[model samples]
Each structure stands twice: as structure tokens, then as C-alpha cells.
Target chain A: MVDWLTMTIQMASLAMAGWCLVSTFRDQPMLVPHLVGMGLLWLLVIGQGVVSAVALIGGEGPEETVMYVSYLATVVLLPPACAVWGFMERSRWGPAVIAFACLVLPVLMVRLEQLWNPVV
Target chain B: MSDTTAPGRALRTGPGRLLVAVYSVFALAATARGTYQLATRFDEAPAAYLLSVFAGAVYLVAAVGLARAGRASRRVALVSCAVEAVGVVTVGAVGLLAPSLFPDDTVWSGFGAGYGYIPLVLPFLGLWWILTVHRKDRARAV
Candidate 1:
């Protein structure tokens, strides 16, 4: 189910972010593994975005189409943007960028869920 | 310039860069949200949406000011940070006390409660960083 995949991606993203934060505080470079983890997360987000878009178009009737689309756009772009910015810094800040991005992932996921099933 | 060359000049080269990075992200998010809201649903919450636009502008200006690190940029950043702090506190209070007034949420609603209160904390951090960096420059001058 899409819900399961989304939850998995969210947890994985958070774990990666936590790892990045620890590494940043410890003053370490973001190794290849870190980058790869982020890449996979982004791929998952992209897949989610496509699924959500299709569902919306197919009359699933997202609670707020505008908000849902905005969330989708933000989630899809987040990882690549962070990757570019992180690579540029080349210091402890690089891992810090990853940390921040990782932290935001869960928040975005929560928002996405809310948009899908708004109570009010 | 020599002051920057001085050994005591604080390196803007560490976590400081990460601060800028986060600020930049907020800047982009706020701007996009404001623009989208204004374009699509202006009638729904004009005041809140406009405030979102203003918050975005302040974030953008502050981020640029911090990144430049020149004398003028520092002054701009200080002013922007002050404005942001005032705006967040005021909007947060208003949103909490007069929830009906905001038909929809803005970035400062309940002191950025939706965003983990980062908006409330970010301005303080920005001002602190600016002052810290300036103090280091002054010390290096002597």
C-alpha cells in the first residue's frame, strides 16, 4: 500500500537526518552512503508525488488540491536542493545541511497526510 | 579586509553556513506559499496571506544579508531580523487571540507552531549570529 511506503520513506528519511546531525556535530564529512541514502529518499518522494497526482486527477478528491500540490512540489525538490547546497559547503555544514533536510522530511510527510485527509 | 585576515576573526565557515542554509530554505518555502495563496485564494484570507508574503520577503532579505557578510549587509540583516522578531510575536499573538481573523494559517500563526516554532527562534538566532560575527570583526580590528 502507498501508505505503508510513505511511512517507510518518512522513517528512513528521519533516520538519515538523525545520522547527518550526529555526524555534523561530530565534525565529519557526509560520506557516499549518506548521499546515497538521501538519493533514495528523494526517489521515494518522487514516486509518492506521482501516485498522489494520479489519484488526485482520478477524482480521489484531495482535501485541498492547492495545498497538496504545494506539498508535493516541496517534497520532490527538497533532497536535490539540499544535495546541491550541501556539496557546495564542503565542511561540517555539509552534513548539517543534510541534517536540516532530514528533519524537514517528517514535517512534510505529516502535512501531506493532513492534506489527504483534512478533518475540517 | 585585513580584519578578515586576522587570526582572531571568527570563521564564518562552520555551523554558521548551515544556519544560512536553513534560512534559505525557509525563505523559499514562505515565498512559494505566499505567492500561491495570493494568486489562488486571496479573497479567503487576505490579511494572513499578505503577512505570509511579508514574512517571505523578510526571510529572503535576511538570508541575503547574512550571506553577504559586508558592513552594509550586516546592518540590513540586523534590521530584517528585528522586523522578523516583531512580526512573529505580533502575528502569533493575534492568531492565538483572534483566530477568526485569520481565515487560513500564515507562517507566523501561533508563533510558527505549524513549523515547530522555528520562525519564532530563527530571528533570534539570526540576530545573535550577526552580532557575534560583528563583534569578532571589531575585536580583530583592535
Candidate 2:
């Protein structure tokens, strides 16, 4: 995994979380900006997924291959899932959904790192 | 009490919708992890694996029940959340007191420390949403 890409995703996700929290606190609905922001984050995640999948195919896969793949799937799926659900709600808490998903991104990234480099 | 008796508010609206999202994630996580563990090495830790399955089941039931937003669904949600709350606490304590009982980490082991303790808090949040928020929203509607 590219360290800078991972760091950029983490920072971007947290920034989205912060933006969503502001919307939530202000009792505002999830507007187009939030959706766009989340879309950007999702793109980054998908990019990471493509890179990692290519690496794995090239034999740089983690020891816990199954777990890593599942987590990778999770990282790829979450933003879109959250965005669709949030759009369905049309309430302040809609952004809260995005916020929650964003927060989970870093945690998943940390897990990915661990899975990639399991202690011998 | 009245809110519990009131025609049962829609759990897929407002904050309840967000709760549904959270619960759905946990349900997916627990179920996926449990199935993987059981499929790969059930013999290594039957107790923990079984508990993982149980936790996943509870989350799934609760999330679906909440989303359905019916009287029976409300009951299902309540029961599942109650079960989850009790399961997390009891399993957490047992895992701490008798580590041998859990050779592997279940969703509730160490009070869900592995999963950032969201497992420990989720059921309470579920209960609060079911019991209190519905009442408050109903009152506001009146």
C-alpha cells in the first residue's frame, strides 16, 4: 500500500467527517456538497483498492488473504452504501451516516496495514 | 410506556435511520467474520465462534426489525437489543474472568475492545432509540 495515499485517504475522510458533523450540528440536511465530498473520498478508496488488488495479483498479498480481501471489499463498498442510505433519509442525521462511515475508514485502513504486515 | 404502546413510530426515519445504518454495518461485520471463522477453524474455538454467530444474528434481527417499523417489528427490535445488551455484558465478563472460555475473540470479547467497544454501546443506543426517542418524538408531534 502507498503510504501517502493511505494518509491522504485518512485525512480526507476525517475532513468529510468534520464537514458532516458540522451539518449535523447545524441541523442541516445532507446537501450536494456533502455528496460530492463523499464521492471524492469514495474515488480515493476505489483507487486504493485497484492498486492493492494489482499488487496482490503481482504477489504482494497479505498472509491473511481472506481477511484482507474482505476488508478491502468493505473499504471499497462503505462510502457508496452510506451515500445511498443518506440520500434516502433526507435529514440531518443523513450526514451523520456519512460521518460514521468516514470515521470507520481510518480504522479499516489501520486494520489493512496490520493485515498486510502481520508480526512474525 | 405510552410510547411503547403508541402505534409504533417509523424506525426508518430521522435518527433511527442512522441507527439502522450503524446496526446494518455491525450485522454485516459480525456475520461475515463469524462465518469465515466457523468455516475455516470452528474446531479451534467453538464457543467463541458460536457466540460470534449469535451476536451477528442479534444485530441482523435488530436492524431488520427496526427498519420494518411495525408493532411486531418493534417487539423484535426490543428483544434483539435486549439480548444483545445482555450477551455483550455476560460474554465480556466471562471472557475476562475465564479467558480459557474464549480462545478466540468474539464480537463481545473484552467488551468489544477489538472492534473499538462499539459493540458494548450499540445495544444501549438501540434501546434508547426504541424506548425514549419514540416517546419524545410522539410528544412533540402531539
Candidate 3:
């Protein structure tokens, strides 16, 4: 279940990132779609964070606790922070920021997976 | 609201602000991670953890300086970026040469290899952006 949600979120983020890259290159405003994509992404990240936290408190291994917690915190904080920063920049760069944020999502997901399955 | 006006005119507006935002995020994350690692297990890897803390401090100072947007702030940002660039390169080289020095991971470990080399690239970008802004300001003054 968590894996499916994580995959969906990653796909959505990738799509948004592609859109943002195109929009930035084409000098588009990127106010609407970026906002929508980012909003959804934020919700997904928060959900992941909650699930991870619950799992952690429910006697997850301490060896991976710190890494999981740190990653969760970053995921929770990233979207809103990017939103504020993107909104501040009124140029095509606004979407560029969104693109950068989107790019980070997949990398973060990869890291999360590594933490979840250390042997792999 | 003249677009051409210089000095104290929003240093971190437009695309530049995005850079600042990214830097700020890194600053906060690195600081928190470094602090946690240091406090919890200093004996495990003192060198790596201390470098992490220093990297975090550099990021924080750079973010603050860029966001402030003044002459002094520009200087501070420039200096911070310079230091960050040197630190990343030096630490990265050292990490590669002597893996034993870092029993654990630092942000600059392997030239930010864990973080997609963004740490290595970020300082250069930051320095370029700050210098570009300064150049624009100087042109306006002249």
C-alpha cells in the first residue's frame, strides 16, 4: 500500500517536473499547474511522513530510526518551502524552482526506499 | 518601482530568489542532521560530523546573507560561498583520498555523491549569481 502510494507520488512529481522544465524553457507563468501539482505532492509527502512516524513509534528498528525521521522531516518541509520561494520569483524561474523541487522528489524517494530496504 | 534602480533593491527576487530558497532548505536540513549526528554519536565519526556542522553553518550564513540583500550582505554571501566552494572541494578530495577519515557520512562526502553532487555544484552557482548581481549593481551605479 505504501509502496503504491510512493510510486504514484513519484510519477506525479516526475510529470510535474517535466512540465515545469518545458514551461521554464518556454517562458511560461506556471502559476496554476505548478501550484496544483505541488499541492498534491505536499499532501502525499505529509501522508508518507505520518505513516513513517507511526511505524517508527510502533517499534521499528532503532538503527534506521534517525535516517527515516530525517528524511520524513525533509519531505514534510520541502513542498511548502518551495511554494513560498517559487511564488516570490515572478519570472519563468518560478517554474524552474518548481522543477528543481520536483527533481528532488524522485531522489528523495530513492533514498527512502534504500532506507526501507537496506540490503537492496 | 523603477526596474533599473540599484542598491537595496530586492537581491533575491526573480530566479535568484529560487536559488536562495534551495540554499535555505539545504541550510536547515544540514544543520539539523549535523546536530543530531554530533549530539547522538560523536564518537562514531568526529571528522565527518564536524564537517557536516561546518557545512551547515556556511549554508545558513550564506542564505541569511543573500536574503538580506545589502552591500554588507552581498559581501557576506560572497565570502560564504567562497568558503563553501573551498570546503566542498577540499573535503571531497580528502574523503576520496582517505576514506578512513570519515567513518560516517558528511554532506560533502565524496563531493556530495550521496546527494547527487548538488553540494559540489551549488557553491559555484551561488558564487556566480552573487557576482552577477553585484555586476549589475555596479553597472547601474556607473
Candidate 4:
């Protein structure tokens, strides 16, 4: 996993979470802009995933390969999955769902980092 | 949220939507952890892993029941939430008193502290949301 990419995803996810929180408080439903933002975030996550996958194929990965890959798959899929789920709802809670997913993304990235580079 | 018990205003709108999402995540997390442990390290801790899988199944049921948004599913979801609440407390207590019983950390171990204690709080939230929706729907119908 690229360090800069991981940092970028975390920052972007938090920013998305903040934006969605504002929308939730303002009683605004999920709009096109939220979806667009999620789309961009998903693209970034996919990039990180691809890099990790390539590295793994090249035999540079943690010992807990299965757990790490499962987590990787989850991180890659989460944004788009939540975006679709949230978009289906036509209420302020739609953005709330996105916000929750966005918040989780950062934590998952942290976990990924630990898995990728466990410290002695 | 037009405050109507309309068809479109099903259980999976508003707060229910968020609940469903959270439940789905837990379901995935618990099920994954349980299955992975059971498959690879079952000899180390069978009971704990089983409980994890069971909890995951309950979460899955609750999520589906809420997302489906019908009277029957509501009942299903309600019962599962009750079961989940009881399961967490019982497991948590066991972990505290008889740690040997678990021998490993399940989702409910230490009241879900492993998973940031959300497992402890989730059932109550689910109960509140489901009951609230039922009461509101009934009140509007009347």
C-alpha cells in the first residue's frame, strides 16, 4: 500500500464525512454532489487496492494474507456499496448513511496500514 | 418523512436506513471473523467462534427484516434484536466470570469491546427504532 495514497484516502473520507454531516443537520437529502464525491473517493480506494494487489502478487505482503485481503476487498467495495445504499433513500438519513461509511473508511485504512507494515 | 404511513415510507427509510446499514456491516464483520476462525483455527476456540457466527446470523436477519419493511419482517427483526441483546450480556458476563469458557474473543466478548462496544449498543438501538416505527405506523393508521 502506498503511504501517500493511504493518507489521501483518509483525509478525503473525513472530508466527505464532514460534508455529509452538514447535509444531515441541514435536513438535505443525498444529492448528485454527494454521489460524485463518493465516486471520486471510490476511485482513489481502487487505486490503493490495485497497488496492494500488485505488491501481493510480487510476494510483498503481511503474514496474515487472508485477513488482509478480505479487509482490502472490503475497503475497496465499501464506498460504492454505501453510496448506492444511501442514494436509494430519499431523505436526510441518506447522507447520514454515507457519512457513517466515510467515517469507517479512515479507520479501515489505519488497520490496513498496520496489517501491511506491522511494527516490531 | 411526510409523517405518513405511506407505502414508500417503509421501515427502511429515515433512521431505519441507517440502522440497516450498520447492521449489515456488523453482520459482515462478525460472520467473516467467525467463519475465518472456525475454518482455520477451530481447535483453538470452537465455542467463541460459534457465538460469533450466531451473532452474525442474527445481525443478518435483523438487517433483512428491517430492509424488507413488512409486518412479518418487523416481528422477525424484533425477536432477533431481543435475542441479540440477551446474547451479548450473557456472553459478556461469561467472559468476565469464566474466561476459560470462551478461550478466545468473540464479538460479544467484554461487551463488544473488541469491536468498540457497538455490539453492546446495537441491539437497543435496533429495538428502539423498530418499536418506534411500529408505534408511529399504527398511530398514523388510526
Candidate 5:
């Protein structure tokens, strides 16, 4: 895994999560800008997926190929899925949903790192 | 079904939507893990894997129940959440008392320490949300 890319994604998601939380606190619904931010985050996740897939194809993947692939699929899907769900929810909690999903990303990244380098 | 949900007051609306989103994510995670484990090596740890599958199903049902607006859905959500609370407590206790009983870690192992204890707390939160937020028509039923 590319440490810099993973760190960048984690940082971006955290930043977006902070913004979404602020909106939620202020009783604001998710807006267009939030969707755009989600789109950017989704793109980053997709990039990670592609990189990981290529790495796996090159035989430089984790021992648990299925687990890694499954996590990758989920990582790529979450942003868009949560974004659409948030869009349908026209309330302050809409952004809260995104914020929660963003928080989950760091955990998933950590899990990905662990799966890549299992402890002996 | 009990009654038509009030406008903007359905369990699927507002903050309830957020709860449902979280539940759905857990559902997906648990289901994926359970399916993978069960398919790959169910014989190695049948009990733990079966528990994992059960937890996944509970989460799925809870998410669906909470996201649908109806009396039946509300009942479904209530029952699922109750079951979840009981299951987590029982599994956590069993895992703690007899760690050897489970050859592998289930989602409820160590009271969901792997998932940051969210699994332990989620059911209580669900129950609280249902009791308080959807308390309108269910008062008599309760």
C-alpha cells in the first residue's frame, strides 16, 4: 500500500467529516458542495482500489486475496452509497450520515493496512 | 401495520436515517465477513462463524425494519433490536467465560472490541431511539 496515498485519503475524509459535522451541528442539510466533496473522496477511493487491484494482479497482495478484494469493493462503494442516501434525507442528519461514513474510512484503511501486513 | 407514519416523523426520516445508514454498513460488513468465513473454513470454527452469520442477519433485519415506515416494520425493528441486545450480551459473556469455546473470533468477541464496541452499544441505542422517537402509537402496545 502507498502510505502517502492512504494518508492523503484519510486526511481528506477527516476534513470532509469535520465539515459535515459542522453542518449537522448548525442544522443544515447536505448541499451540492458536500456532494462534490464526496465525489472527490470517491475518486480517491477508486484510485486506491485500482492500485490495490494492480498490486494483487502482480502477486504482491495479501495472503487473504478474497478478504482484500472484498474490502476494496466495499471501500469503493461506500462514498457513493452514503452520498445518495444522504441526498435523499433532507435534514441535518443528512450530512451527519456522510460524516459517519467518513469516520468509518479511517478504520477501513487501518484494517486494510493490517490485512496487507499481518502481525506475526 | 399499526398506523400510517406521521409526516417527517417516520423512523426512516431525519436522524433515524443516519441510524439506518450505520446499521446498513454493519450489515454489509458482518454479512461479508460471515459469508467469507463460512465458505472458506466453516468446519474450523462452526460456532463462531454461525454466530457471525446470525449477527449479520440481525443487523440486516434491523436496518430494513428501521428504514421502512409502517407498523409492521416498527414491530420488526423492535424485535430485532431486542434480539440484538440479548445476543450481544450472551455472546460477550460466553466468549469471556470460555474463550476456548470459540476457535475464532466472532463480531461480538470481547464485546465488539474489534469494532470499537459499537456493536455492544448499538442495540441499546436502537432500543432507546425506538422507545422515545416512535413512542406515539406504541404506547398502548407497550
Candidate 6:
């Protein structure tokens, strides 16, 4: 796992989470810009996933390869899934859902990092 | 099976939407962990893994119940939520009292201390949402 990319993803995910939280508190629904932000974040996550996949293919993966791959799949799927869930609801709570998903993303990323470089 | 949802007040709307989303996450997390543990290390801790799988199933049922807007589904949600509330308290207390009993950590172990205690609090919120919706639904009828 590239430290820089991991850090970037965590920062961006937290930022997205904070913004969505602000929108929720302000009684604003999920908007186009929020989706676009999620789109960008999703792209970043996908890029990280692709890198990890390539490394795994090269036999440089972690010991628990299956678990690591599953976590990656979940991380990759989360953004778009939550985006659609938020989009379907036309209420302030829509942003709340996104906020929750965004928060979870960073945690999952942290877990992924741990799995990638387990402590000996 | 019968629909009891109010106009613009479906089960998975407003705050309920957030609840469903959270429940879904829990459902996925718990089941994945539970099943994985069951598959690889069930012999190491059968009781704990079984309980983990059960907890995951309950979360799944609760999520589906909350997401679907129907009279029967509401009842299903209410029951599952109640079950969760009871399960967490019972398992958490037992785990606290008899630390060695589990031999491994389940979702409700230590009152979901591993998952930031969200498992402990989730059921009540689910029950509240279900009841609040039920109340509003009843009020509309009367």
C-alpha cells in the first residue's frame, strides 16, 4: 500500500464525510455537487484498488489474501452504493446516509492498510 | 404484506433511511465476519461463531424489515429490533460476567465494544423508528 495514496484517500473521505454532515445539519438534501464529490472519491478508491490488485497479482499480497480482497471489494462498492441510496431519497437525511458511508470508508481504508502490512 | 405507508412517509424515508443504511452496513460487516470466522475457525470457538452468525442474521432481518414498508414488515422489524436489544444485553452481560465463556469475540461480545458500541445502541434506534412510524401510521388511521 502506498502511504501517500492511503493518506490521500483517508483525508478525502473524511472531508467528504464532514461536508455531508454539514449538509445534513443544514437541512439540505443531497445535491449534484455532492454526487460529483463522491464520484471523485470513488475514482480515488478505485485507483487504489487497482494498484492493490496489480500488486496482489504479482504475488506481493498479504497473507490473508481472500480477506484483503473482500475488504477491497467492499471499499470499492461503498461509494456508488451510498450515492444511489442518497440520490433515491429527496430529503436532508439523504446527506446523512452519505455522511455515514463516508465515515465508514476511512475506517475500512485503515483496516485495508493494516491487512496490507500486518505487524509481525 | 399489506402496505401501511403514508404518503411521503415510507418506512425507509427521512431518518429511517439513515437507520436502514446503518443496519445494512452492520448486516454486511457482521455476516462477513461471522461467516468468515465460522468457515475458518469454527472449531476454535463454535459458540462464539454461531452467536456471531445469529447476530448477523438478525441485523440482516432488521435491515430488510425497516427497508420494506408493509404492516407485516413493520412487525418483523419490531420483533427483530427487540430481539437485538435483548441479545446484546444478554450476551454483553454474560461476556462481562464470564469472560472465558465465549472463547472468542462475537458482535455482541463486550456489548459490541469492538464496533464502538454501535451494536448496543442500534436496536433501540431501530425500535424507536419502527414504533414512531407505527404511531404515525395509527394516528393517520384514527
Model 4 C-alpha lDDT versus the unseen true structure: 0.93
The candidate that achieves the highest lDDT relative to the unseen native structure: 4
**lDDT of model 1 at residue A103?**
85
Every candidate's TM-score, chain A alone? 0.92, 0.97, 0.91, 0.99, 0.97, 0.98
- Chain B structural similarity (TM-score) per candidate: 0.89, 0.88, 0.93, 0.94, 0.88, 0.92
Off by over 4 Å in 2: B1-9, B133-142
lDDT of 5 by residue, B41-84 (tens): 98999888888888999999999999886768888999999999
TM-score of each: 0.83, 0.90, 0.88, 0.95, 0.90, 0.96
lDDT of each: 0.80, 0.88, 0.81, 0.93, 0.88, 0.90
Better of 1 and 5 by DockQ: 5
Worst lDDT run of 10 residues, candidate 2 chain B, spans B1-10
Docking tier of model 1: it is acceptable
Q: Which should have the higher lDDT, number 2 or number 3? A: 2
Misplaced by over 4 Å in model 4 are B2-9
lDDT (10s digit) by residue, model 4, range B50-104: 9999999999999998888567888898899999999999999999899999999
Worst 10 residues of 2 chain A by lDDT: A84-93
B44 Cα displacement, candidate 2 (Å): 2.1
* Candidate 2 residue A14 C-alpha distance from true site, Å: 0.8
Flag the better candidate by DockQ, 2 or 4: 4
RMSD list, candidates in order: 3.5, 3.2, 2.5, 1.7, 3.2, 2.4
Give the winner by DockQ. Answer: 4
Candidate 3 per-residue lDDT, tens place, A14-116, comes to: 9988998898899876587688879988898888778767877787633667777777677778788887778667788888888888888777887787787
